[model samples]
Target: MTVQPIVFFPDQRLRQVAAPVVAFDKSLHDLSIDLLDTLRAAPGIGITGPHIGINLRVVVLDLPTSDAPEFYVNPEITWLSDDKVQNEEGSISMPEISAPVERPTSIKIRYADLHGNIHEGEAAGLRSVCLQHEIDQLNGIFWLQRLSSLRRNRLIARYKKLGHA
Candidate 1:
């Protein structure tokens, strides 16, 4: 597994919707491995296909409290709790100060496994956050997109100023 370069914010490609994973092919498996490698390098909980410029509906996640890597393909949130709370959220692309955003307390998600088997499960806490973050990528949305327009603009400017845009 090799670490893939992360596509940072302000890149228009980040705003493009990812395509669904059609089959469990060699390339798809390789992408998943690379995503795990990249996520480990980021020292973060999750990584999405789009972040590595793949534009396929795949994500790799490993919470700080967990060691086993989790993979999701064409994942969809099937349910969400009404209770919500605000927390500081960060991203591989932004790599800036974590911005506070309100998100559901829990979510039930469905996705295909590496072997092309469908699976559904509930996730809370960091896993939930990771799921929501990665799912947003599948739809061409970022965590910062949940922020106010002014704040989003400011963050983009900051990234540009940092020479990462």
Candidate 2:
């Protein structure tokens, strides 16, 4: 496992649509490990392939106090609840400001594991938020995008002032 550099906002690669894994190869497993390593080292709850400019549909995450991490490959939302909870969220890619964004408290996700095994998981609370956030990154969307226009503008201004955008 190796720590990979995270790409910041406005990077073209972050907006690139990622390619899905055709085979569960050793390279994909290694990449997941690296992403987990980077996420842990950065002290972040999650990280995506696009965040590292890999343009691959992969994401890794662990809850705030969880020691066990989970990896998702080609993850997609299978179902979502209409019930939403607004949580203050931040990202390693943009550390300047955290804003409240509403997301489902529970979600169903389907993905292939490192071993080429397909699985489905139900996530609620922080796990749900983390899943949605990372999946958004795969779709070229950021958590900040969930904020209201005014808040998003304010955040961008703050990030610009901090020289992080």
Candidate 3:
């Protein structure tokens, strides 16, 4: 597996919806590995295929609380709790910028595994936030979309000040 170059923010690729993963073959597995490598190299807790310009519905998250990293293919949120929490969220594509994003405190999700088996699971706290964020990327909604326009603009200015477009 290789660490693919990240598709930075403002790139149209990050705005395009990722295509569904139809074939769960060796390529998909390798892509998942590459995503994990890229995520680690990017030094972020989460990343998606769209983040690397693959435009495939895939996400890899390596949370410190987990024993190992996990990959999700074609993941979709099935249910969201009414309880909400605003946590500081950031994206690897838009580095050096983050804003408080309010999302469900818990979520039930359905996704395809590398082997093409469908599974359902639930997550809460940071894990919940990460899944929601990555899934948004798959749906062509950048994390910034979750923020208010004012806050989003301010962060973009800060990102520009940091010498990144």
Candidate 4:
């Protein structure tokens, strides 16, 4: 697997909503592997197809202490708890900045495995945060968009000063 180049923020493709993966084939499997490799190389806990310019509803997550990475194909949040928590979220596309974003404390999600098998699961804490973050990417919402206007503007200015934005 190759560690594909990530598409940075402000790229038009990052704003485009990802298309759902329709075929469960070797290409899908290869994309999953490439995503995992790219995530590891980015040294991030999670990544999605859009990060590497592949606009498909795919996400690869390697939460801390997990035995292996998890791949979600065409993931969708089916339910979210009213209870919310604030967590610091970042993205590989915009590596230099992170801000606290409020999200559901727990969520029920439906997604398919690489083999096209459907699964539903509940996630909480960091796992839930990561999933929500990546799903937002799949839906064309960059993590920075989660921040408030003041915070987002400040972060963008900081990013620009750092020569990354």
Candidate 5:
């Protein structure tokens, strides 16, 4: 698998909802692999299929503590805790820009592996933030939508200044 080009932020593809991954086949597996390569090339911890314009509910995350990237297909949040935490978040598509985003501090999610085996898990802290962010991408909710209007506008201006708008 090879690293594919990212779809870049402000690209409408990033805002379009992804279709559920239906076939647990070679193409899906390859796309997941390519996603990992692309995420590593982008040097980001997490990325979704929409980041590369695939429009499928897939995500890859390479946390600093892990030796390999984790893949999630058609992941859905099952439960969200009342507790909230704010962390500086950015996207592979939107390089050189990040803003503090507040999200549920803990979450329970259900997703499928490449083999189509469904699994449920709970995450907290950084993992929680990453999952929520990527799932939102799958749901057509950009991280900018999680920010205040003023903050979102400022970051957008900065991105434009970076010549990416």
Candidate 6:
């Protein structure tokens, strides 16, 4: 698997909604492998197709300390718990910044595996947060947008100051 180049924040393609993955074939499998490799190299827990400018609803996640990586195709949040938690969130696109974002403590999601097998499950804690973040990217919502305006501005300013914006 090759490490794909990541599309950074402010790229117009990052704002485009990803198209659903229709075919579960060799190419899709290859893309999933590339995503895993890219995310691993980024040293990030999660990544989406848009992060690499693929424009397909694919996500790869390998939480820190986990032995295996997970791949999701066309993932959608089906339900969110009323209880909420604030977790520090960041993006590979905007690597230099992170801020606490309030999100549901638990989420139910529906997605397909690389072979097009449907799966539905609940996620909590960091897994929940990571799934929401990556799915948001698939839906054209950048993680920074979840931040308050003031925090977003501050984070962007810091990124710019670091010559990464």
Q: What TM-score quantifies how close candidate 2 is to the native fold?
A: 0.94
**Model 3 Cα lDDT, one tens digit per residue, 55-165:** 899989999999999889999999999999999999999888888899999999999999999999999999999999999999999999987899889998999899889
Give per-model CA RMSD.
1.3, 1.3, 0.7, 0.7, 0.7, 0.9
Error of 1 at 56 (Å): 0.3
Computed on alpha carbons, the lDDT of every model, listed in order, comes to 0.87, 0.86, 0.93, 0.92, 0.94, 0.92
As for lDDT, the candidate ahead, 5 or 6, is 5
The candidate, 1 or 5, that scores higher on TM-score is 5
Q: Please report, as a residue range, the 10-residue window in candidate 6 with the lowest summed lDDT.
A: 63-72
On lDDT, the leading prediction is 5
- State how far residue 161 of model 4 sits from its true place (Å): 0.8
Native-to-model Cα distance after best TM-score fit, residue 68 in candidate 2, in Å: 1.1
Model 1 lDDT at residue 84: 91
Give the per-residue lDDT of model 4 (tens digit) for 1-165.
899999988897888899999999999999999999999999899999999999999999999968999999999999999999999888889887888899999999999999999999999999999999999999999888877889999999988898996
Candidates 2 and 3 compared: the better one by TM-score is 3
lDDT of 5 at 89: 96
What lDDT, from 0 to 1, does candidate 6 have? 0.92
Which lDDT tens digits does candidate 6 get at residues 1-165? 899999998898888899999999999999999999999899899999999999999999998756799999999999999999999888899886888899999999999999999999999998999999999898899988888889889898999998986
Q: Which has the better TM-score: candidate 1, or candidate 3?
A: 3
- Which is better, 2 or 6, measured by lDDT? 6
Q: What does candidate 1's lDDT look like per residue over 15-47, in tens digits?
A: 999999998988889899999999888767888
How far off is residue 82 in model 4, in Å?
Answer: 0.7
